[model samples]
Target chain A: MSTEVAIVGIGMHEFGRTDGVSGMDQGVVAVRRACADAGVNWEDIQFAFGGSMAAGAADTMVSLLGLTGLQFINVANGCATGGSALFSAYNTIRSGVFDLGIAIGFDKHERGAFRVNTKGGGLGDWYGASGLALTTQFFGMKINRYMHEYGITQSTLAKVSEKAFRNGSMNPMAWRRKPISEEEVINSPMLSYPLTQYMFCSPGEGGVALILARADKAHLYTDKPIYLRAAVVRSRRFGSFEVLAPSIALEHNAGPTVDASKAAFEMAGMGPKDMDLAQLQDTESGAEVMHMAENGFCEHGEQEFMIQAGDTEIGGKFPVNTDGGCLANGEPVGASGLRQVYENVLQLRGQAGARQVPNDPKTAYTHVYGAPGISGVTILSR
Target chain B: MSQVPVTEGVFTWPSDSPQLIGSRCVACGNHMFPVQQGCPKCTAAETEEVLLGRRGTLWTWTVQGFPPKAPPYAGNVDPKTFEAFGVGYVELPGQLKVESRLTEADPEKLRIGMEMELVIVPLSKDSDGNEIVTFAFAPVA
Candidate 1:
């Protein structure tokens, strides 16, 4: 039987802009802080797996992290980069080859909507020329169809953002920490139909790192080890509606998030109800609403009532995005997934001071979805 | 006044009623737009080119409220002059849902499951002063 892995230390650079600091430098800071938290030396880490989208090579950090000459792999799986890095580190320790390692992710993106190059994104010139390559349009179109089908109201959408900012106000690391009223959110500039400016998460900069060790030896690093129950990544299946696609087949199919969520629950031997809290991708307000259902937390059209009932609030039945999530953190792409993991670790260990949930949470779940249709889900427990 | 297609094989040109070009799998019957070599559903290698239907229903839509960045974006840059455009997926019966621009820019004017017909509209002008045309879907009267 394969051995289990446990996260002994977690650290993060505040999720937002840091003008002068390079992305790689932020990563180094995160790694150092994680080492300090785990009470382990940099020389103790046996291997490393890291990723960054627009930042420099992750392996180059060894110049400052010390020339340990350990095996380091760079992952670039779009928005799932952090989750992919953690998944690799988990499997490595489970294979019994390495006793300890670290997974890191960081990115610094330019202002405004993420630009998709026609040739690089595998899209034809006509696609960009006609303005069909924008990611915001996809989000708006998707939520528009969903609202029509499920009877979700505009107020529900605003509520999701309101909760994000409210929770963000309690968390120091969040970029958008000021709470905006629902009316203000609705009255905000409409970037896409039905989605206001406040509803969207901007592209920003930050870094996060987590140190993992074999479950048997986890006690050597920290007293409270957060066990990693499962880490799974999945890609889009046939006929699924995804970004950058010019056409979709008539046959409908579930998106990648469903497959990844199911596999994660099965692997962890737990259900959605068992999760004390969750951190879901909130690229925009609609994403969180749809992802909640897609991850099997609720059925389609249930988010409308769930948001109204305040079930996803910090004091509610099921707290989500307790660290403000991507909506408040301002997604740094590479660091976004690991930021979720970091927040879960803090919450599971009861270290989240201001943003702590009502109950002492033992189990946590995280899900992230991004371009080209890929999703990563992870389950953790104290 | 000279006019040219933005890209060939996307949609037929110089016709009163134009249809989009797509690929259909010979083995599994999967359809894809702008033509491709293989099937994404059944992994079938053999496929045939076919002309898609002219009329379809709006599957979903949204309005672009601001101008996109340049390099990839080849549209009007001035924010004050940039016109918000409607983008949507038009599902042709028994074929596939093609993502395209809608002639209508007003979100209030568009609705789900509305009947739409294909039209070729001028997107922009090339360096040679030729009108570059592309496919779009318009609400049918």
Candidate 2:
């Protein structure tokens, strides 16, 4: 087996409300679809890594998928669960212990704002009882400060969501398919100051699975294997602004997304300019705007200009979120990160139909940022 | 009704001037609120409890426009009676910014870098009709 790992197959369960369908059942469908795509069977998967934050234990899926006794570790990294699972599977293959493995993520969440488990999140009961535990508040405050320091306008935030829905209209699996105008997004009911209801992605259900194979054997599985160039996860540094923090250090510093993105690019021997397209986390419109700079796609304030110029549009200089990102797809914590990777894989393979980025992109990048200040970044090449 | 702090040891109670209880890292001089054990910055085990400054500037803020869920949120859940509250981080000079509820809920009343002072306010009431109080920051008039 070669040291390099490649994704030979990919599959997904439609991202949205699926009444009466279990989250684990979605994962089983995705796994089966991926197996069929790669012309492999369940027993061919030597090892696996998967996770579902709100759903049942990932390892228990074996009861339905056949208990092959393969080592399947459950990962719980909040919103970075999918990326963490993919990272683990990549390393498992790179370590030469397994030639084939699967990384799967699925989740079903209650409809409404995600209730923070104060005690589980390392916070006290008073922290939540005092009504200071909402993640939307954190996003609003952080972006409010960012807009103040960076001169970004509320219109820019609206534009980002407008673009998300526009792209989502073209994605078959996206939850929100109708195009929303910038004016509509800005005029929507204010969930938080400067953030309208349209700007935030709700918690929902979905599942994604990818089959990995050693690079040397990748050709045997499929001719369109997407090589996994890099996969890295990073936690927040001391002074970075993170979700659910009761306090912040006076000395501000770079966030985890910046760290993870830099490390992923370095590992791939490429730079942001080398990427033909990218999929940055857009849990909220502000997150997409801030993460553009955090991922080194452009400087801190350049998004104001790039956004206005439509530089991030599907046909623009650098396409982003061709699969509508979390904003349009809604975030199923465990599946959100892998959804980014799945989009990049589809874009790189030139299978992204209407939302396909121009120029037959050869390299793609993805970043996912989540609560308690952790980020995951991945680089893929066709 | 008798007044009681929502949680003990978070801040000095029953005093006219109450300061938040935080820990200062002896190794790196880093400060954190609500009293954590180790230094998150320098990872030093040695630290000392210190009272944070009462006055600070609003670092950033937003409004909790909707009523949050119960259990974790002890505040009023009645959408009609639930008043919107300002949530923000107040930057204490040379120390750290503590996240707190702002007395002023109007967006026009709050601004980044505005001076704010800590004050005790009623968060809710317990089963016995005792008022549960929590610390918050108010814009200095």
Candidate 3:
């Protein structure tokens, strides 16, 4: 209900691990590409939001982009950092505070294992240490629980991975482009019970940057500007004990993805049924299925059936992760969220090429979540 | 002697030794751990401090079969050494469900709704004999 902020330009560095480019270097490349795509000069940008999880504060990402004159804000919200940054940029522009802004999400996550800063003043000691470790393990444990509760076979989870790899094969940007069979996914190294290596996203390096401007100025930047209809951010709170019933509250809280998605749908004046394309934060294959149900894309425990029915394919009811998701595209932390947004921008712009959803899509949604249950949902339209 | 520099932090036993202080919003009566600069729910900056309980019921858990990819967590253990460590979601007395690591490595033994307590232990030891302590949880009788 605020001022309309449209994505004037989008740019992405080739998605892969690059030894030569640090996070900042890759960020600069994407930023330059976005600026060029938007037909705007670096000096015209009034504000900048840099999103990265692995980089330390003052890590040249903000300054190196030649955005020194702009009001720069650095954000690190775990995996959802990029989407969070985009939300901040949209709000800033919508507030009439800035006319042009850039949200840059770039990360060379291959540098280290994924770690969340659960330091003092964040959560209780018991909740910080054990809770985080427990949540990371929750995916595997939930898969086990799903197996026990629903009588789902290991192959049920494997089918999700097999489909992701198959979709990745058609995506030039995906890290693992080779089609993987169900037997291969089930037989891969088991990280946790019922979850195999192929079931998880491979850690890699990449960059995704987006440019936003006031609706009035959007056409000056690009003829095909994607409008930001809704951007919602929400965090999970410890629900009641009864809410923790048998299968609901396994992780940090009632899946924030669903809550954020619902809020976004209401804010955008639309529902899951109206979505033409979607790019979800699929850190693991099981998450893809869980989120599909939780986000109202499908009913509970019906995601496996949907995948088997090819309802989630490029030509199906709703094409998901056309550029491949974190599972096949690699979860590059900071870059992953914006990377999803970039895919939406491309699909709406009719530039997705081989991975393009069959029908000309008008509305798309991208969702991303981070540690301790930070969630961001964005609704984009042409 | 190892040359790791120990970071200064208190370690608590029975899991909840070092109490986690959180702020309860005076406006909305919402509770948040590790305290917040402002109430995220109602945007209230004024609040009161409360001590969270130690013991809770296990919600669920996972083991770090693979060593974390981050630094300062290196050389202590290899990912292969621990195939499956138990982690759990523990429900505190105040209806708070905290995520924590279980003392048991076998995932099979971990049961839903099992009782658990908090334990703060050393995450790693620096070369200078300093202990980098962090929080974790273990099962209770």
Q: Tens digit of lDDT per residue, candidate 2, span B26-131?
A: 9999999889989989999988999999999999999998888887999899988989999999999999999999999999888999999999999998999999
Query: In candidate 2, which residue pairs clash?
Result: none
Q: Candidate 1, residues A1-382: lDDT per residue as tens digits?
A: 9999999999888888898999999999999999999999999999999999999889999999999889999999999999999999999999999999999999999999988877877779989888888899999999999999998998999999999999999998889899988899999999989799999999999999999999999999999999999999999999899987899887788899999999999999999989999999999999999999999999999999999999999998888888888889998889999999999999999999988976789999999999889999999998
In candidate 1, position A141 carries an lDDT of: 93
DockQ numbers for every candidate? 0.86, 0.89, 0.19
**Ranking of models by DockQ:** 2, 1, 3
TM-score of each: 0.99, 0.99, 0.79
Q: What DockQ does candidate 2 have relative to the true complex?
A: 0.89
Each candidate's fnat: 0.87, 0.86, 0.18
Better of 1 and 3 by TM-score: 1
Pick by DockQ: 1 or 2, better one: 2
lDDT order, best first, reads 2, 1, 3
Highest lDDT against the true fold, candidate = 2
Worst 10 residues of 1 chain A by lDDT: A114-123
User: What is the interface root-mean-square deviation of candidate 1?
Assistant: 0.9
lDDT of 2 at A78: 95
A1-382 in candidate 2: lDDT tens per residue? 4499999999899999999999989888889988999999999999999999999889999999998989999999898999999999999999999999999999999988899999999999999999999999999998999999999998999999999999999999999999999999998988888788999999999999999999999998999999999999999998998999999999888999999998999999999999999999888999999999999999998999999899999999988888889999999999999999999988988999999998889999999998899999999998
Candidate number achieving the greatest DockQ relative to the actual structure: 2
